[model samples]
Target: MKIYSSIALSGVAALMATTAFAQGGTITINSFGGAYEEAHRQCVIDPFEAETGATVQIVTAYSADAFAQLRAQAQAPQFDVIHFSGGQEIVGAQEGLLDPIDPASLSNAADLYDFAKSNLEAGEGPAYSIAAIGMIYNTENAPEAPSSWTDILDEAYADHIVLTDISNGYGMLGFLMLNQVQGGSLDDIQPGLDAVSSLLENGAIIVSTSPEIQQEFAQNDAWVAPYASDYAFTLRNAGLPTAFVQGEEGTPASFITANLVAGRDNDELALKFIDMEISPEAQACFADALRYTPTNSKVELSEEVAADVVYGPDAVAGLLRFDPTVIEANRADWVDAWNRTIAQ
Candidate 1:
């Protein structure tokens, strides 16, 4: 069955009444633009609308912009749900912008992998998000896929590599990988920053936007990019000779956190969506279409795809998981250090 069913006329009437009483008429979701957005609509929204009968309106924005908007609306929440990285979710939770989730109602919660559940909880008792991590390289040119971060920095990859912009959360994880390769710890990222600066100096292009990264790699022969495992999978599915790597140091991992807008009008609905998100159907569709590791334990991945996803048993063992708390606290410092040291 498709994930979401269309709302019946009777259900639509009930939703309309509920919305009217709540002072809002629709559920507005803000998400990262491009293919991910499309996948979300297909896998999450369409089904939800069919089943619940409430209108789902998607608002597209860059990750930074989405965060900014969420903060601006904190006093009077506008969006019902916000799809953001775990790091951003940590910040939101700290600022009292997100609501705690109830796992009891989420029937498929048991299906989530242990790591995904633990990462979501972060020891605070509630999960903020679930995510997967991995690397992408073009198979057409690379021929032999790289199995670690060090491979990206090899002189052989010079001038043919593209990396995510360092400002965003995914980019930060990429930076963490470079740090791991350089013998630097996430506790002190200066060494990693230096390594990245060196790579840029040697010809790594800074791809600040996902679309730019996608286009560059898809149209041109930009053979390698350090990206979210899910994104890399999306590229490969599109018939690009792209291959994702499970770094020797293991893969770096992150989550797609759900931010609770402080004054959300549809708190119940928001929670419902979160519950559904972790459902077997939703999680499966998300993993199958977007190449993300399912946080839902019930959702199993194909053996081939599982090998590339960060949370895959073998792959997870090799990953250096980034702590959202640490990232949240030091984001400014990291950014400043990156800007000052990178010279880019």
Candidate 2:
């Protein structure tokens, strides 16, 4: 059985009731749950429902679990739309699990930045938000903020670091980035393995969930971690004395995209929903709420909010993205290497 969290919005109930007498009652969206899901509800779902008088049901799934569910229900998909972070979108598209999107169908498509509009893999949909991986440290506990990826493994932070397993997206990026920084490529992750193994030997704590990281920080057991910049902001806003910074080398970034599930109902509505996701209003809301960089070129964020996100063309231009195609092809091998050498 697949595990997924579900929520039917309040207004959605009324819409569902009305539609029960008319036609299909809801549109299903699959996404990562918690604060990120809430951000989607506020920025896109609520507004879309208000405008179209449609109810949306949100189902939570991520990474490998998402692909598992799709494969299990290959004949008939449960969700109308799906959201993917990074190269996973390309993976799903290649497997024929996702339907190709028409640029002409998206009203807001022309307004998106080149990166957001990029058809990374054929049939992969439009990108709606940008997130960057970086180091987060407790300003009060750490003697100094970590300025580089290597800092987490430094002797000073040895006992106070929280490391993520390879299964997590942030963990994968962290591992890949460390490998690059230490003169290893995706094809050769031995340097990353050797480095992380050394750190683990020094007492670094390993965790898989975001909440676990938060718990460690709350308990004052961890002083620093490698994670997304938006999550770092979330921790600080939650009253943790936290600061986020990219490594001295550069930052690895990802685009969160929305795709229409293959053979699911409601293509028109799904296209509209995706279009609205990149609209100026929805984009700004996401940016203001979670510091997600808006994909819409027309959306102009204020200085304070933009400061936290990777905003503007120059910043976006400077972002280092692992080729989704390359990452997709070798992720499993990298994970295996991580488990064998580092987890040992």
Highest lDDT scorer: 2
Query: What TM-score fits each model?
Result: 0.77, 0.81
Number of backbone clashes in candidate 2: 0
Q: Which ten residues in a row have the lowest lDDT in candidate 2?
A: 1-10
Give the Cα-based TM-score of candidate 2 against the true structure: 0.81
- lDDT digits (tens) for residues 201-289 of candidate 2: 99888789888888889885589898888887788787887777778787888878888888976888878789889888788888888
Q: What is the lDDT of candidate 2?
A: 0.79
Off by over 4 Å in 2: 1-26, 151-158, 201-203, 323-333
Candidate 2 deviates by what RMSD?
6.1
